[model samples]
Structures are given as structure tokens and as C-alpha cells.
Target: MKYTIFSTDLTNPLAVWQHFEGEERVYWHDTQVNRVIVAAGRVKRITEAELADYPWAWYSQSFFDTIEDPIWQNMGNELVVFTHYYVKEEGKAYWVTATDSAPVIAPMTVPSVQHTYEMVTTGDYTAWQSLFEGIQQAIRSGEVTKVVASRKVAFHSETPFQTASIIGNLVAQNEGAFIFAYGKGDAVFLGASPEVLVRKRGQDFMSYALAGTLKKDDIHDGGDRLLHDPKNLREHQIVIDRIRQTMLAMCDKVDVQATHIMELPNLYHLRTLLYGHDTKDSILTMAKALHPTPAMGGEPREAALAVLKQFEPYERGLYAAPVGWVCGNTPLFREAGDGLLIVGIRSALVHGQDLYAYAGCGVVAESDCEAEYTETATKLQTILKAL
Candidate 1:
């Protein structure tokens, strides 16, 4: 495998620096390699038969079906670099830190701080409620078991959104996670996720699928009350059951941690951490076994996905999809073949002045519409404040 190094100055970076960007191609950010995966001009809209010719083809409605994953190669070792935003127009792009006085890579620089502000205010709550009602009606009529619905709030700003700052903070704060930042036109997807769907550790591979949601208490002593809630327990169990069945075929050993307290910025969740060790499988194989877990998708995987297809008006695209980094021939710093993958939750795609934010909750037979809607609102607040 061959690798290429590209960079721009720190003062004027392009959005491609934050996201591996190209037209009609799939650009993968291999964080472990400190480089990118680029397969330009290989992507096209094609039939399923044609896609079979490519080994790593992914189909999303927003983008056609003929996309292929890039080939992996070793480019010696590269320095860890960052992106800075210097331009904003029809779409936003950034500059990446480069090695020398070469323009092979675009300019790289962080966006100015004057561009930051909270644009998503409580005024959008009414629109969110209306969308929530639509989802509830579907659930009540049995059209779908669960719909991971979301909404977008526009962050009107002249300066471009900051991508490098958020990624740097996530990497520095969560060493066990993957930092994924990308911009589609003006919308940017900035995610710092710690969850892993599948990871390779030599012959032994692992995955953890988390589910369930709740609100954290302001009082210190409210912990016990939150843990004992029946609603919370049920939500958590649904996720565990879904993951267990999904991985039953591929895992040598599956150990599920009993329900425990886990907290995010806005809310809390009853988390049952599942540990799967594969003896005969690779990480990608395990991922194929479980890519979109019940946490993002729903129980009875196929059925849930089918429901989402019919009921969801907006295309999910990369929202609620797997967003993370892959190790490109790099030894795991802590464990062999260790890489990080996280569900793109509590995230947004910023395109120019329009910001698209996404949030979803697990719905069961006993779930309530108002409460679930509120949960999503809490989730949205996390990324909304950062803008």
C-alpha cells in the first residue's frame, strides 16, 4: 500500500482538511494513520449488480449506491494535524496543517473565534413538538415500532463553523474515542464519540452496543431514584436484547454488563455494555454482523429498518450512522488492532448558515410521546450550545 501526505498552512485551512472531501467519492478519515482514504472518480450511481463488482460498496439514498471504500496503504508515519476554517460561501471549507511550501494540500487554519454563538434557541421547540406528534401517531397506529426522528436548527452566521476546535477538544478529552469531523457543503458533522461498534485486537475483536436513555438529576442524592425507574430499566433491556441476538452468530463469548448508570451532558441512560470477543472473525466481519445496532436502529433489526424506511420523511443519510476512525496499518497504542467507532448521536451537519442537528430515543410499547420528545430536545441542547 502507498500513502500520500498533504497539508496547508495553519492560517488558512479548507473544510476538506477537517473532512476528507471530494466530488462523487467516499473520503475516509483514517485517524490512526494520520492521513485519509481517497478513491476519487470511482464513485457513481449504479445498480446493485454493478455494486457487487466493488468489494466495499455502501448505499445511501442521498448519495448513490456505487460508492466504494478506498484502499488502505502505509505512508510511513505522519504527524497529527488539525484544520482551520478561513472561508465561507455557498459551502464552507477549511485549511489543514501541511509540511512545507507546497499547495498539494489546501490551506489549514482554525476559524476565527468571532464566528461562535448559540443559534438554536428554545423558539424551535414548537416545530420539534409538531414533528414529535407525527412520530407518535405512527407509533400509536403500529406503523413503526420506533422512529429515530430528528430536526435541524439554522445557525445564521457570517463566519464559518469551527471544526478543528471541536475535534481537538474531543480527542484531548476522550482518548478512548474517535474524533470524526466533516462538512457537507455548508453543513458540518462534528462528532467526538467514545462508543465502539467493533474493534480489532489481533485475532481477538470486540464490540460494545449501548442503549436506553434517561435524565440526570441535579441533586446528588437523586442517583438511586433514577436507577430504580421502571421505564428506564425497560428501555435499557430492549437495547441489550437486540445486541445479544445480533451478535449471537459471530461472537465466541458475549458478556453483558448488568444495567448501570451512565451520564451524558444533557441526560442519563441505563447502559448495558456488551463485550464480544471473536476467535475466528475480523473486526470488519463483526461489524457486518452488527453495524447499525438497536441503539440507533431498533429491535428485530430488519423489521425496524423497514419501518424507518416507510415512515421517515427525511433521509437519515449519515445521521445515526457509524462515524469513526480506522487504523491504517498502525499498531494500537494501547491494545492490538484497537480503533474507535461511535454512533453519530448528539451531532450536527453544518452547511453554511444552516445547521442540521439530530437526536433520537428508544421507543417501546410503554413509551410516551411527550417524554420522548423532551428527551430529544435535551439531546439537541448538547451540540446546539456548542454552535
Candidate 2:
């Protein structure tokens, strides 16, 4: 295969994103690294059953999830990359990094589909609050220290929805968040998230443990209130502790970074950054071990996951899962990292006009059913507003 590179000011990368067909489109943007990437045309795809047995990766691609359950074999896992562009940001400057099978040719064309269904699905607030209470009861009984509870609300339209338009809104509005969309055809997962499961740089590993939540518009300095809120702190600490342990066990050397407050557009979280010694076992090794961190799963990982699996009314397909790409034999021109995976939170799934949106809150002993219910609503606002 041949490859070429180029640059341009792409106001709406989604316009370029339209070129990739079927399950061939991928879009990612990170202000932390100051880069916006739009990868199209699936030049290669990699799938793994388990990280411990997976072969060496030779492409910069993204991977999906199966059931995180040990007893069950992986359902559908894939890595996609090498046919794309990487847009980087320097001091007050922006650059687009592109890699392709050939030089650009063909006018940009947008894909279209007719609506096949029209149904609006929403969550039962009373029922969800009841479930949240059950999780909190488990926490009180010492059944699990913490559990992240989630709910889904979907919309089925008579007209097929446009991925380009949804993504355009994401780029135009969401700021300082991990933005991404994976998959194609009628089934796709996309979102602007504030959590990073684990990030691999050249020789370092970074895992972001983000839990706890309060509305950004709740208080003048939400960060200050979030820091002192004992309930939120307890919820956030469980995630930090679990991640630190996971890194120490699976990685060579580990650094447990300090915990701080991270504020997003409509929400705030207690955030901790963890780093592990870099080795060949970077992304794959760490992600498998740290995924579904207490932030997504719960304390005593297995028990909480069991609770979620049994109680949650939905499949969770890729919501609260992992997204982003890994590098191939030849890395991209950018210096952001070896590869990156963002915890697929604050996200939604689109299949025609039927859009399934999801949101969740961490449940601890101190959690109030009504309050936690409110948290999930806060979490869904980003994508809900975007749509």
C-alpha cells in the first residue's frame, strides 16, 4: 500500500469524514494534546480476544469492546487506523497531519439515508431511582463499596439522522473534552467525554480516574464545593485507589498522581492522573486491566460489574467502554501519544433516526437516590443538547 500526507484548515472535519463508507469512519479531537484527528477509509482492522494473547499491533487504529466479563469470551473487538489525518496544535498555531492510501481526489460527498422508524424512548425516572437506591443499599450493606449506575434514553425518528451534523455540533460546542465517533452504517457510537481510561505515549502510560459529579451551573466555584463534598470525594477516591492498584499490578513502574478537580461544560468531576513505566505493554496491557475503573464499574470490580449487569436495563454495547486508536508499524507524524483510549462516557449510539443516549452516576454509601438520579440527567445533557 502507498501513503501520502497533507494539511489544510478543515473547519468541519465531518465534511471530510463523509468520504469513509460502511464501517470506515473515525473522528477524534483532544485539546489536552491540542490535536483534532479525522481518520477515514479503513485501510486495516485489528481484532483481539484477550490482551494477554493478542499479537503485536502493526497499525495505528482504534479498538472496540466485548463483554468485560471473564467467563464470557470477547464478543466483538477491533482496531482501526492508518488511513487518516492528525491535526496538531502548537503555541497559538494549528497544523493538520494527514496520511492516506493516495493523494486526495474526488469532491467531498455526504452520505444519506431515509428514515425507517419513528419512536421516542425515555427512561422511567421512578424506576431508575429505585435501582439507584438498590445500589446504594448494596454499598450500605458492604455488598460493594461503590457502583456506577446508568440509564438509557433513545429517540427513533421517521427520518434518518446525519452523523455529519451530529459531529459538527460536537466540534462546534464541546470544549476541552475527548471527542470521538467509531463504527459506521446504521450502527455507530459517538460522544464527547471527559474521561480517559488510559493513554499511551512513546514511553509512558497515563490513566485518568474521573468520578463524582455535580452540575457546573450549580455553584459559582463548583470545583471548590466538589472538593469538600464528602460523598463525592469518597466516590472519586474509590476510582483512584482501584486504578492505582491495577497499574501497580500490571505495569513495570507506576506513579500515582495527585487528585484534583476537573470542570466540564455542564458537570464537574474529581480527577486523578496515574502514570506507569512505559514498555511494549502500554495501551493493551493497561486498558484491559484498568477499564471499567471504579468510575464505570464499582469497588471490588467483579461484584459491582455483576450488579450493573443484572440491574441495568440495557446492553451498554460501547457506552462507558473504550474508544480511540493505537499506532501501527509506522506511527503518525503527530507526537500526542503512542495511542489513546477515552472512557466512552457522556455518549450515544445512532442507528438511523433511532438514537440511544446514555448517562450514569457513581453510587456510594452516602448517595441519595434522588440526587444520583439528577446526576445522570446532568451527564446526558451534552449529547442530548448536541442532538
Candidate 3:
């Protein structure tokens, strides 16, 4: 199908987001550049194996490996699909038309939404902590150095959830985050994430490694305590070392930065920035290689992945998976245009009156069960406030 582009103006892209809220739609606010895109239509779907060839593609992680739990059947396995999308940039909204002659256009007016949102949760805080004790025992037994133990906040309400308003609020409050709203079937996966899995601009690639956690309210020293904490440092360093080593394996040249503090509304993290020129030709390959970092999967990837599959209870689905687009028929995603993907951290799944929010903490030998439980709560506060 031939594509067309028409430029217009949009001050509140959320209006376009509201108008385009369909069973299948894409909303991406490029945090790197000042731009927003909302694409809607039933076009096509592609797999990860097919992703390298197409530039206009999007994907989410799924746990096909773990089949013990039945809750995951709703989301299925990981996905990488292609779709023509709209772009709003440089104070102009561009309508990305598909192969058909009829062109899609952005709505000209903003939407007003008013409703009461009430939610009740069945939180797995204590249970998740119990699992962490097991992880701690495993760590001491030399089974693994670290494992990310996570919890779920399953919320159900009588009132219908307002996605547009929630997304708009997320955008307004977190300018530094990659704001997104992804809808499929009866479920929508949405969040404002602060982690980048990998971004490919030509042969240049960048990755962000974030681990360790401390609730901001509890940190009386304003990160002085965080910077010195031994457990947090060890957890954070594991992620840093893993990412740097992995990237160096695939890149011609690489730069790994010293650890720094990354503060959020409710918490603080030990963050590192890494970048390099990839020796490989494909951006998709670079993304797959970086996912399930020690931050998500734990040290000794293969063993940690096995632990996660058996212990995480619910399938991870897209909690820490890669989500972004690539261009089709291009030698490089950057060779044709720009391509970016961010880790789906600080994310949740919303369906009808039920919403399942997820948060995780990297568990190590020194991990205290109560402290790890509190860290997950701190992470959940991000989406809790948005909800």
C-alpha cells in the first residue's frame, strides 16, 4: 500500500488520542524529541523474526515459556507487528495514510471527560515478599546472584476507567518519561516509563540500565544514604556490569558511564547510561539482546530467566519488554528514518473494570524481605497516582 502524509496543527495531542481510541491504536509521546503520535486502524501484524525488515513496527513481551499459569492466555506470547502511524511534530500534525486512497485525519477539537474512578485492589505484597525470601536463599546458595521479585495490584471498579484522562495526566506529570497507551482487544497496556531498552540511530545505539530502589520519602539524606547503601549498590552494579558487557560483545565501540542517581516521584534508582556503535546491522537484534537485563532477569541470564519463569506467578507479558517502532524497507531503521524503543517498566494492563499493575525490585543476598516489599510499593506509587 502507498502511504501519504498531510501536515496540520495540534496543541493538545490528547484530543487526537481521545478521538482515535479504538480497539487497536498506538499513542507514543517521544520523550527524546518534542513530539506525539497517535495511530489507529486495522492494518497488519508481524513477528520479532520479521521485525528487522520493517521500519513501522511495534512489539510487547510475552511469557510463552511459562505455561503453568492460565492468566497469561489473554495476552498470549511476545509480539512484534507492523502498522502505518501518524506523527505530530514541529507544531504540525502529520496524517500517515496507508496503502488505500482514503486518507486518515486528526481531529480538530479537544475532548472533555468527567467521571468518578473508584478502584479496589487485591495486592500481592506479602506473597511477593515470601517469594523474595526464596530468591534470597537461592542467591546465598549460589543459584543466582540476583532475581527481580515483583508484585501485582489487581484493581477492579464498578465505573469504567477513563484511559485518555489517565494518559493525559501521566504526560502532564512525567515529562521525562516515555508516555504511552497501547490498546489491543479488551486490554490496554499503558504507562510513563523512565527506562530506555535501546535506541538505534544509524549504527549508533544507546541503552539505560536502572536498578536498585529506595523510597524518596524514606530517604532522609536526599540520596546520601542511597549512594552509600551496600545492598542497593551491589544490585545496581550487577545491572551496570551486565549491560556494559553485553553491549561490548555486539558493538564496535562502547561507552559505559559511572553510576548516577535517577529520582522519580516516589523513589530513587541507581542509573547508568551506555551507548555504542553496533557491529550488527539490525536494530531489532540490538533490542532483543538488551532486554531482560540484570535489572529485569537478574545475573547469569539463563538461570535467572529460568527462576523468573517458575516464580513470577503471572506471566510478565510486557512489564519490562521493548515497545517502539521501526521503518519498513530500509537498510537501517535510521538509514530510512528514526527508530526508538523503551523498556516497559513502570507499566500496567487495564481491561474494563479490572486493571493489573506491576512493579519489581532486584533481589540479592542482602535483600531484606520487608525492604524489598517496600521498594515494590514505592514503584507502584507511580501508577497508583496516575490511576
What lDDT tens digits, residue by residue, belong to model 1 across residues 50-158?
3222323222222111223111111101111122112211233222212232234444554523345546545466655665566566667776555555555545566
TM-scores, in order shown?
0.66, 0.83, 0.88
Alpha-carbon lDDT of model 2: 0.68
Query: Backbone collision count in every prediction?
Result: 24, 11, 5
Write the residue-wise lDDT of candidate 2 on 146-174 in tens digits: 88888888777766677777776775667
Model 3: per-residue Cα lDDT over 1-387, one tens digit each: 445555645456676666666647778887657778776665666654554454466655553344343434445344434244566776666565555442434556443344344446544665676677677777788989998877777876677677887787777667678988788776788898988887777778888888877787654776777778898888888888888887888898889887888877767777888988756656667777777788878888888887876776666777777787665544322453246778777777888777788888888887778877877777777776776
Q: How high is the CA lDDT of each candidate model?
A: 0.50, 0.68, 0.71
Q: Tell me the deviation in Å of residue 272 in model 1.
A: 2.0
- When sorted by lDDT, best at the front, the candidate numbers are 3, 2, 1
Task: Give the number of the best model, judged by lDDT.
Answer: 3
* lDDT score for candidate 1 against the true structure: 0.50
